[model samples]
Target: MIISRTPLRVSFCGGGSDLPAFYREHGGAVLSMSLARYVYLSMHEYFQSDGYILKYSRVETPKTLGEIEHRILRQVFEDYGIRGVDFNSSADVPAGTGLGSSSAFTVGLLNLCNAYQGRYEGRTTLAAKACEIELGKLGEPIGKQDQYGCALGGLNFIEFHPDDSVTCESVPITQAMRERLEAGLVMFYLGGTRSASEVLRKQSEQVKNSKRALGSMQAMVRQARSLRAEIMSDVDLIGPYLHEAWQRKRSLADGITNPRIDEAYERAMAAGATGGKLLGAGDAGFLLVYAPDEARAQVCAALPDCKAYDVRFDSIGTTIIYSD
Candidate 1:
């Protein structure tokens, strides 16, 4: 049996710019961090069958890659030439929560496959292969940040060049700075979930049509780069940077925010959150609050319907939990 685990991610800035529709023309950049929460995959050989068994939150089946209907999963297995394997997958969080759960699952499963074949792939290779399977093969309207963030598993600055090359660098900060950032971050679960594909499709269409949204997206990427530098330098003004990025991000798509989301953001701010943004596609997912440690409890109390999760930065991206 072989088990692999990969961390989910929270994209801090430069969310929309990673889409090929935007990046292929103007390039892309993103600042993100992976959390301790993870997606786990367990794969083993089956003596009696020449097929695959797959499992996730609400889906379970045994079949070939061509037989599976889930676009991402099917493409991944096909690209990896995986067959005759019994694979069971699961995650700590549900999908469509803006936590990059799908990417984490993909990275973890691919890593397990590599281990099964006696191939040890590094984080960059694993991430790049996952991207090739998803973006290149599946043609999903998504960004590179998800795959890289899941594979690298830390606070990262990712730059995508026009030539389709990506560069990922870990953000360096002192222990004191790390502690301060952790104390100020408050994550609350919103009441619903959203389809990222639906949101991203709209953004892609707009960008393809030469809309102002693309320009705004580029601006946001630049802001993210600036904010990342400040955070790495241990600057105390990270909250305002988050606020600026959030304001620009909301302009990318109309469905990114709703009445309930607005109410939650307002309440969090009133309760002492320095700045906050709705994570993921915006119709539903998590609201990330930036505040001092003293203000976290009050912020959580203000939003009684939401559950708060205490998460820290995860430095390890993906790893083999066990193999034999």
Candidate 2:
């Protein structure tokens, strides 16, 4: 049996810019951190005679590639010829919570498949293949940040060039500083989930048509660069940076923030949160707040509407936790 674990990602800024609609012309960059949460995949031969035994949120027993119902799995399995194995997946969080759950699973699945074939792929290769499978083959209208972020596993500045080349630069942060930053980040769970494809599709069209949106994304990329520099010295600018970035991000597309979301943001700020933003494509997900440790308690208390928790950073990307 071989089990692969990959961490999910929280994109701090420069999100929408990673889409090809924007990056193919202007390039893209995002500062993202890998969260401790993970997607775990365990695969081994159990009952090989009948078909492929799959367990995710649902069960599947498909004897042929065409019989598979999960789009991502179907494409990956067929393209790679992966079959006749008892494969099960479980996650620390549910899908569509803006924490890059899908990409985390994709990266983990890719790693598991490679390991099954007696191959071990590096992070960049796994990330690029996962992107090709998702953005190229599956036609998910998402960006490249999640793939690289989940696979590379750190607080990094990921760049998407017009030539289709990508780069991930880790933030020069010490462990003590990392813990300090993590402490100030308080995440509140918003009730509903959103389809990232729906949101990204709209934002893609907006970026192609509106210079205002493109310009906002460009500013975000700049902020991501600036934040990288600032965080290493001291995290004094993170709160205000998040505030300014969220304000610009709201202009990318409609429905990124709703009445309920706006109310929550206001309450968080009123309770002393210096800044915060919705973690995903934005209709609904976790609201990540930046506040001093002293203010975190008040921020949580103010948001009686949402469940809150602290976030931890993960430095390990994807690993075969158990292989034999």
Candidate 3:
């Protein structure tokens, strides 16, 4: 049996600009961090039959890859020439919570397949293959940030170039700064989930049509760069940076925020949160708020309906925890 674990991600800024629709023309950059939460995959040979068995939120047994119902898994298994294995997956959080669950899954699966074949692949290769499978083969209208974030781990500043090349570098910060930043931030589950594809599809069209939104996204990319610099020196700027990013992000698409989300933001700010934003493409997901440790209680108390999730930064990317 071999088990692979990959961390999910929280995109801090530069959310929309990574989309090919935008970056292919203007290029893009994102700043994000991988969370301690993870998606795990365990696979072992199934010699009882000459077919494949898969299990996740559901179960599937297919004689051929063409018969697999899960689109991502089908494409990956076919690409890797994998068969006759019992594959099971579990995650720390559900999909569509804006934490890059899907990308975590894809990266983990790719790692598992490579390990199964007695092959070793580096992070860049793994990330690239995962991106090709999802963005190229699966045709998801998404960006490149999540795959690289999940594969590379850490707090990364990722750049997507028009030539389809990506560069990921660690955001420089002291351990003390990292700890303080993690402590000052809180994530509240606002309930419900959203389809990222639906959100990204709209945002992609908007990126091509609306100059205002496009300009906002460009400003956001700059914000991500500035945030990277600020966090290393002045940690206090985190909150205001999040505030600025959220304001620009909501303008990229319509459903990114609604009345309820707006009200929650107001309440959080009133309760002591200096700044915050929806973690993913919005609509629904965890709301990440920045406040001093002393103010977290007030923020939590103000949003009595939401649950505060405790998480820290993860430095390890997609890894095989067990192999035999």
Candidate 4:
């Protein structure tokens, strides 16, 4: 049996610019961090002679990629030549929650398959391969940030060059800055989850035509790079930058925010949060807030329907928990 664990990510800035539609022309960058929460994938050879057994929260079956009903899993297996294995996958949080859970799952599953095959590759290569599977092979309308963030955790700035070269840099934050960020940030569940692909597809189509949207995405990437520098020097400004990025992010897609999400944002702001935003593709999932310790109570009170969690930034990305 082989098990691989990959952390989910919270993109702090530069969310939309990583899409190929935007990056292929203007290049892109994203600043994000992984969390302790993870998607765990366990794969083992099935004693059964004929077929593959797959298990996840919603889908379970003894079928190959073509035979399975879940599109994501089907594509995943097909890309990896994973046929005739018993795969059981689960996560710390539910899927479609804008937490980059799907990418984490893909990374973890690939890691497990590599271990089973006795193939050793660095995190960057593994991340790139996963990106190839999802974006290149599967043709998913997504960006490179999620896979890279999940594979190489920590507070990082990822640069997507025009030539398809990806570079990961660690944010040089001081101890005091880390404390302030951990104390001030809060994540709350927004009562539902969403598949980011659906929203990203629309954004992709827009970027293929609208120069305005493409320009806006490029501006967001610049802001993200600037924000990373600020975070390393002075963490106090993250709140304002987060607000600025959120304002720009909402402009990328019309469905990025809804009444409920807007209400949550307003409540957090009213409760003394300096700023915050819905974490991923944004229709639903987790909302990240920057509230000082003293205002945490007020923030909690403001969002009655949501469950709040105090999370610290995870420095480790994906790893093999147990193998062989």
**Predictions in order: lDDT:** 0.83, 0.89, 0.90, 0.85
Model 1, span 186-227: residue lDDT tens: 789987777798898887787677567777888888977887
Q: What does candidate 4's lDDT look like per residue over 5-70, in tens digits? A: 899998988997788877888889999988889999998887774677888875566544678876
Clash count for candidate 1 is 0
Give the Cα-based TM-score of candidate 3 against the true structure: 0.98
RMSD versus native structure for model 4: 1.8
TM-score of each: 0.94, 0.98, 0.98, 0.94
Which residues of candidate 1, in runs, are more than 4 Å off?
A: 58-65
Candidate 3's residue-wise lDDT over 123-198, tens digit each? 8899999999999998999999999999998999999999999998898788898888888888988888888998
Query: What global local distance difference test value does model 1 have?
Result: 0.83
Candidate rank order under lDDT? 3, 2, 4, 1
Using TM-score as the yardstick, the better of models 1 and 2 is 2
